[model samples]
Target: MTQQVPDKLVIAISSRALFDLDESHHIYETDGLAAYCAHQRAHESVPLAPGVAFPLVQKLLALNTPDPQRPRVEVILVSRNSADTGLRIFNSIRHSGLDIVRAAFTGGASSQRYLAAFGAHLFLSADAGDVRAAIDAGYAAATILPSSGQGEGAGGQLRIAFDGDAVLFSDVSERIYKQRGLAAFAANELAEAGTPLPGGPFKEFLAALHRIQADFPQDAAPLRTALITARSAPSHERAIRTLRAWNINIDEALFLGGMPKGPFLKAFGADIFFDDQQGHCDSARVHVATGHVPYGVANEAPASLPFSVVSQ
Candidate 1:
């Protein structure tokens, strides 16, 4: 049985987010379930390649000292593959030297119900539907996108970035922008500059990370966080004050205004960046690993749900 660490920052990642299962997934999509299972059985001994979130997981796992009585971080594998076909994933984990110990394989079912049981602060997956479900449940979650990042982060420091107005803060302002105009949005922000923006989907997750960061001195913290938002000066005061009001310490805050975020994320050497907008996510994936929050005004589709981030 896997030992539980209740005090640590916990994350749950799906099989496809942890490793590249594109080959088998393609088989499942094209040739159906039987072929997919057969292929998995045939290649059960073959190790899978690392997927987009691998580097981030590696850094998170590395937070535990070599001989600690208890780990500071815990990662649980929550997958859709059945235990029969999941042997390959377990083998791949052993082969890759990853320290992941606990997992929940639900055959072909979604793992939304198990996230709370794992005490997960965050969830990453290739399935947008699952991510949305997790977010709706009030747990922080993101849909992992194809990584174009340089694999390794700056000198082993685990850096994370987030977007504003919809992700870190409720899309209240974003809704104004979409409905009225930029002028009205700016006016409203300036008016409510003293009032803190309501917490968005990621508030609790960020607070948890801040608690971990408190253990180390400012210069030596293992995890570094940045806020890269499209909101520029005049409107920037609200974002700053909102974080201050929450007592959350963000290492860097970039108010790019309307600037493209790809270059900034590349410069930040982020392990993963989260944004609620699809356009920003597409650009960010070119420079670093990106996740789509799919919450708030920016993600609303009148006709149907949006799952294009990693859908076949």
Candidate 2:
């Protein structure tokens, strides 16, 4: 069935990303697997509360239908929980009325291996290790951070926002900026403004989203996307050029030029924002659900680098 739906925009999400399982996770960490299983079994019938990515999942699933030919979205649950303990998650799914029918209950093993089989365009999880594995395996994956913000945009749209460098485009420019400072970075951008930047980890995912968007009338599309990057002026030109070359449409573009992204993302009513920098993710999550994309040069050898450099 999954093979039959190859054209669908499939998203693989972890159970913890879908539900508030903090207490249960803590129990597993402390009392071992048996206790965790016992607790889950004891509370199997009680529906779990929504987690950080819950609202986004809701919106994405709302765009789907039983028809496979038309543009549609499919959400597949990929969890480390064994099917026995995972009954609670399934119960919660039914309780929440999510139309999720495909899943992989991998016991305690990593679920990244199943992502390719399911043809997941994107994967979201709370585990940084799992996210990294998925990224290494070439899927658009992010560690969904805990957040306290409105789940949906005002118009009930799936307003997804992404960072430019490292997240969407390769960190080639970011590495230059980091090593040689802004002056050189600006010079490089000016010199190579015409060249399209290399595709980063999330490029394919963004393109898949664009494909889904192409199915609907422009003004009446069910989903929207924005590029919320720190680049400004000259650097912005290359990003614009790159998106044009890729033929993907980002509904909004905000070149904050290194300003903190919290207020802007809040204003945009972003349901979720993705950035490779932890500091930006930290700031954005205060106002919107944020995902930390731990990829590219920025994430390499982080300890040796200064806090300012890492956060910037």
Candidate 3:
């Protein structure tokens, strides 16, 4: 009989997101792939430093310690490097003691194509193109942003923060807001408060997480989730009612209205934060490990909109 893939929360991540490869990446960009391959080979024995998503991966792996035989989470490394060039990354993984045995080294080919093959619930990568392709392919994916500070969840709790519209829920409401402005959006939300919003890209991923959380005691659960959005008051009611209808429990909900999300996300000690808007992601990445979910109205090409520095 063949061994079965465990029914768990599967996450597919890139080598750059797992470890700090900025120096090596710079070599690849400036000198070319040949120099990059040679550099990696030369530094093969050196352990790579942790990147923005390191803490999140560490805490996620810790969830399995409760039941080694039956782990709740699985992380797969997906990279564009060839198997020969990937030995350094593998060695670093060993040095860091990360239990990431599975990998797909595409040898410069597109690695996002293998995400479904690994049963990945989420894909995180520093490569924006790969992330965009994965999202377009209907997988829950995000472009990992560079972070100045490390994540704050040092207690082993996996704290995940998500933007409400275009992330947890569908972009329908967001499209309305973008087309008709705030007042009309609020009115629409008010009228549809009782109706549940359509599920977005991350909906299935959140449901999977909820299932895992249900398996553990409330106090013992290793994960916590939050809905961090700009929606507030009247508009917020619809989001709340929508989650209730779905029977999903959000550990925390922060409706910041139009305020910047960076400060709030920092206070929350989030291991990772996801948002559809680049502006929100720009702010959040400074304080927490942030991922850009390039979807919905805001991300659409702005043909009629006037050019502005902020918009750029």
Over the stretch 182-216, how does candidate 3's per-residue lDDT look in tens digits? 88789999999999999988998998888889988
lDDT of 1 by residue, 1-312 (tens): 767877788999999999999999999999999999999999999999999998899998887864367678898899999999999999999999888889999998989779988899899999999999998998889999987674346798889999987789998988878767788889999999999999998888888889888888898888899999989989999999999999999999999987899999999989999999888998899999999998987777644533322210
Q: Sort by lDDT, best first.
A: 2, 3, 1
Cα error of candidate 1 at position 282, Å:
0.8
Candidate 2 clash pair list? none
User: What C-alpha lDDT does candidate 1 achieve relative to the native structure?
Assistant: 0.88
Regions of model 3 farther than 4 Å from truth: 1-3, 304-312
Looking at candidate 3, the ten consecutive residues that score lowest on lDDT are 303-312
Considering TM-score, where higher is better, how would the candidates rank from best to worst? Answer: 3, 2, 1
lDDT of each: 0.88, 0.90, 0.89
TM-score of predicted model 1? 0.95
Error of 2 at 254 (Å): 0.3
Model 1 lowest lDDT segment of ten: 303-312
